[model samples]
Target: MRLSRAFQPTLKEVPSEAQIASHRLMLRAGLIRQTAAGIYAWLPAGLRVLRNIARIVREEQDAIGAQEVLMPTIQSADLWRRSGRYDAYGPEMLRLKDRHERELLYGPTNEEMITDLFGGAVKSYRELPQVLYQIQWKFRDEVRPRFGVMRGREFFMKDAYTFDADYEGAVKSYRRMMLAYLRTFQRLGVRAVPMVADTGPIGGNLSHEFLILAPTGESGVFYDAALEEQDWLSEPVDIDDSASLAAFFDKVTHFYAATDEKHDEAAWAEVPEGRRREGRGIEVGHIFYFGTKYSESMGISVSGPDGAPLYPEMGSYGIGVSRLVGAIIEASHDEAGLIWPDAVAPYKAAILNLKPGDSATDAVCERLYAAGAEIFLYDDRAERAGVKFNDADLMGHPWQMIVGPRGAKDGTVELKRRATGERFELSVEDALAKVLGA
Candidate 1:
């Protein structure tokens, strides 16, 4: 995409209200704009990143046998009432009434709706093990929504629900989700540790919160240092093999990890001092096994093998999709701006025409752009070399191709790595090969 044609409203200076680095950078980069307190309108650039993250979430969910199905943002309040959470969910629930005077709500979560859907169609154990997910906007009226998208009242989330006929089947499904979450975060170039967490409003006996450590994070966490080095991608994960899933669970649980809500001082003391890590963390994902909490309450039952009526065991998994964009910045950014992971970066590389008006430089850039490279070409009408370079760096594309009259005269262009700040002069073909190969 050409910068001149793109709708990026980048600012020359940081906004005064943005206190944190991520918030400030997001505003200056024209990624998002606050429409109201705790709510935002994602601009073109921000929406690209959001879509990339959503793609990764979808890929990982599909890998674990979870099918995608979008649910409504507005759901009938009667469903929540059946789950006995209409009164219990508190003020965060955005309750309202339609023109017909029927109760409605913007769903904070979809347990009730999912249960109601499952109960209506599923009637036997043959459809026992089913997992469905959706990526959609969710709203919770936070009393104090701050820190940009990190704690926004209206945000995007990928929520998945699983229904199984037995306790053993439910546990296996939960482990598959845990592995999926690890793979999802890893692909996004972030190391998110799975820590035991409180069930909170989800109401479950088994739950885990995937946290990414950042100094400016909201929650305090205690975990083993070894978890930092573990490579989830290298681990053998077989979603259909229950034994493999159990082994993966055991490996992860061997370490001591817990959020403040579930922190055990005795367990922390047991770890060697060198292995103990206490720090702030941001919750990027959460999973829960709630047994028959929603199913039983909503009359979601199926026939067992013995011909007895059985309420399916259930679980829910969630990833804070919009919040992760801010969390990724918090976990990995320098003084300049965002250091986007290549997998989630809007553009793989940025082609900066340092001498935009120069005939030779334009020729080289034109050839490079024609070679099917995913890049943001800086070909603006009124930007200086320094301005173009700074904008490219601030946007954090993985690679930067700088073409100038000097380099064009020499039949070369400078290819720079955004993360390492290393530069090398190469022919147009060579540069294209290197950047696209990455």
Candidate 2:
């Protein structure tokens, strides 16, 4: 993408209202714009990042055997009524009325709706275990929606519901999701710790909130430092093997980890003095196992192996798809701007044309852009070298290819790593190999 033609409306001065780093940088980097309080219109650059995050979430979900399904944003109030949460959900629920004067709402979550849908279709123990997920927009009428997308009223979310015929099955489903969340956050380039958390509204005895460490976060987190060093993807987890899943869950939970709501001094005291870690963290994902909560409330029942009516045990797993954009910045950005993880960066690298029209520089940049056009954002704008450098840092592509007249004349370009400011001057082919993986 050429900067001259791109719709990135980057700002020079920080917006006064942006209280957090992600909010401030998101505005300055031209990723998103506020259309109203607690709501935003994701600009082209912002949408690209959002899509990238969603894609990773989708892949991880698919890897765990969760089938994707698109659910409606607008839901019938009657569904909530059946689940006995119509009046209980409170003001956050965006209630409305349609043309026929029927009670409606922009769904905050899909527990009841998914339960009803699956309940009607699957009738026996044979269809006992299934995970359905969707990446979609959700709205909650936050009384004070601030901090940009981090606390937006309207945002994108990935919500998955699991249906199982028995308590044992639900536990396996929960562990599978826990493993999936760990892998998802690891790939998103944030060390998100799974802490025992309060089941606010989700109504689950067993719940975990995946919180990423950040100085500016709202939640106080306490955990063993060992959790940060875990490479969850390195471990082979067989979702079909209950014993394997149980062992994986036990291995992780054995660590002393809890949010402020669940913190135990007794447990914390048992940890080695040097291993105990404390910090503020932002919650990016949550998993819950609320057995028969929706199924029983909504009268959703299936036949058991013994031919008796059974209420399916259920769980809901959620990843803040849009909020992650901001949370990632909160967890990963530096003074300059966002240092995007390669997996979720809108573009893998940027080609900075220090002299856009210089014959030699243009030739090198054109070759570089052509060689990795799919993964490169070509900065062909007629901007000053300093301006291109600042913008490239602000946008935070993982790699930056600098093409200047001196290097271009010699058929060479400078490759810079965005995260560490590491630089190398090499031939065009070498630069391409470094950025494009040969």
Task: Give a tens-digit lDDT track for model 2, residues 320-373.
Answer: 999999999987788988899998898899999998779999999999988877
lDDT of each prediction vs. the true structure? 0.89, 0.91
Candidate RMSDs in order: 1.3, 1.4
- Model 1, runs deviating above 4 Å: 201-205
Indicate the worst ten consecutive residues by lDDT in candidate 1. 372-381
Q: Which stretches in model 2 have alpha-carbon errors above 4 Å?
A: 200-205
Model 2 sits at a Cα RMSD from the real structure of 1.4
lDDT (tens digit, per residue) of candidate 1 on 1-438: 788888888888989988787898899888999999999999988988999999999999998889998899999988988889899889999999989999999999999998888888899998879999999999999999989999999999999999998999999999999999999998999999999999886565579999989988898999989888776568677889999989989888889999999999998999999999999999999999989888888887899999999999999999999999999988777877778998888888888888777899888888878775455555544588888888887888888888888888877989999888899999888998998888
The most accurate candidate by lDDT is 2
How displaced is residue 83 in candidate 2, in Å? 0.6
lDDT of 2: 0.91
